[model samples]
Target: MVTLIIATIPACELALSDVFASLPDIEIEAERIVKGEENAAMPLLWVRGVEPDDFEAACEADPTIDDLELLADFDEELLYRMQWFDRIGLLFQMLTNANATILEAVGESETWHLRLLYPSREHLSKTKTFCSEHGLSFSIDAIRNMDRDPSGRYGLTSIQYNALITAVDAGYFDVPREVTLDELAAEMNLSHQALSECLRRGTHVLIEDTVLIGAAEFNL
Candidate 1:
């Protein structure tokens, strides 16, 4: 079955991290990936809170960027098309080795929060193993079988959706805590561990899709 994963990778490990490290206030997203000669991966980027000239200066001094061009200007936001050097092999492996697709990527606070889709659970495992070998941390916040909607109705699985509703209706989210975790687990006919997973995964999905700052899906 196809799977959807929400994960985090440290920005320090990404090729463009050094380039944008100077612009800590800027928000960056991988808008889309366009194939170039020799099947090079070039990404159209949307960056906010930085002027194009400043961004240009940063890229010029960064060794990871092979080339860059400004594609549009929206006053506060600028669109850029850029190509990375061979340093971005990790990204290529995620895309081709496991046949995964990047749905979203947001850079902030020394981390890249990503939404990724894979053809199967095995593929995701392959990615994890690959990262382990490379000493790259692939931290998964939530994952589910993308059996119905790929985005999962605002990025939640059916189980997560139900879990949230059950928690809310049972007053699990109340300030005073109307229900205990164990009680909630019993109410849901799930083990305590299972209930914990549901709540944690569901909450992560809800926040990522709704309230996550500067989060956006990559344009396919």
Candidate 2:
């Protein structure tokens, strides 16, 4: 059975550690990371609680971050395409060796919370062992089998699933758009950006699971 692994690692142990330290109050969330060759990938980052000038300057000064380009600028958030050139072993292992899918990756202050989906329990163990041998400080917080988890089967966390469901029920997807993200987030008691991320990730998972080969796996 497929397994979902919840783990935590200090930002210093992962990529962009300096950026996190420089912007201690900033919240960084990965949005659909694209894996590329030569241990480099451009990840869409949703950075919150910092001005564009400060964030860019910090990234420029950080040796780990290679490049950054602004994608969007919200009231209190900025989206950017970022490339980290060093300290990405854990991320590379999760994506390549473990063959895991990153469902959610959020970084705050000094710690990073990761949600990964592996093909089997053994795969997760191997990944864990690799981390231990390399002294990456990767710590497992929880594990769940897809068959046993209500929302795991669809490759989404409980919170992501709930956000998607609530949005649908509130007609957030109606033809004319009955509800805005802010209103829906207020109703759900989640921040505007939080709800937006949940909805985006949840919808992506839903499409990948139901519209793609995922439907064939379950015969829906």
Candidate 3:
């Protein structure tokens, strides 16, 4: 059975770590690959917690980013069409691998997390070898057979699951709100924006599985 692997890579090992470090307050989610070819891709990004102007300025100053164009703006988030000019070989290598499929990728501050589907353990082993040869730090966060987790019944990704559980235990969701996002993030060793994204996505998954799925089953 194909395995779903969730892994984290240090931003320092990636080409865009500096760009992410520069905008420490912003959260970036890869929405989709708008276009892709060998060694290059144009991805639509969802950015939050930064002003549009500030994001533009930061991009202009960051050497890793070739260009960024605002596609849409919302009160709390912005969509960007970004072009990465160089140093994308790692991603290209992953994409070109015949045994894996990249499902989700999000970056915040000093780490990039990716969810990938690998055809077998041998494929994953080869990927790890590839990363090691390239001096990239790769750590697997979770792994499950894709056939067994079609509905994500095990909950959110490991990081998100743990974050949400810790937050709840710490009273983050309580009416009085005992824990601040920053405090919780500190406990998890994650940036505030990253923690926020984790909580948001975790809650969404919980609701979808428990409430939405339940409602649909009964024709509610």
TM values, all candidates: 0.69, 0.69, 0.65
- Candidate 1 local distance difference test against the native: 0.76
lDDT string for model 1 (29-67, tens) is: 778865556635788888888888888898888776767
How do the residues 27-124 of candidate 3 rate in per-residue lDDT, one tens digit apiece?
Answer: 77788753365445788888888898888887886655666788899979999887764666666666666367766677776677777778877778
What lDDT tens digits, residue by residue, belong to model 2 across residues 60-178?
A: 98876776899999878889998876777778888888899988788887788777789999889878898888887987766657776477677688888788888889999999899
- Give the lowest summed-lDDT range of ten residues in model 1: 211-220
- Reference-based lDDT, each prediction: 0.76, 0.79, 0.71
CA lDDT, candidate 3, residue 129: 84
Candidate 2: where is the Cα deviation over 4 Å?
A: 148-220
Q: What is the C-alpha RMSD of each candidate to the true structure, in Å?
A: 8.0, 10.4, 12.5
Q: Candidate 3, overall lDDT?
A: 0.71
Name the best candidate (by TM-score): 1
* Predicted model with the maximum lDDT: 2
Which ranking of candidates, highest lDDT first? 2, 1, 3
Rank candidates by TM-score, best first: 1, 2, 3
Alpha-carbon runs more than 4 Å astray in model 1: 35-39, 149-153, 156-207, 210-220
lDDT of 2 at 49: 86
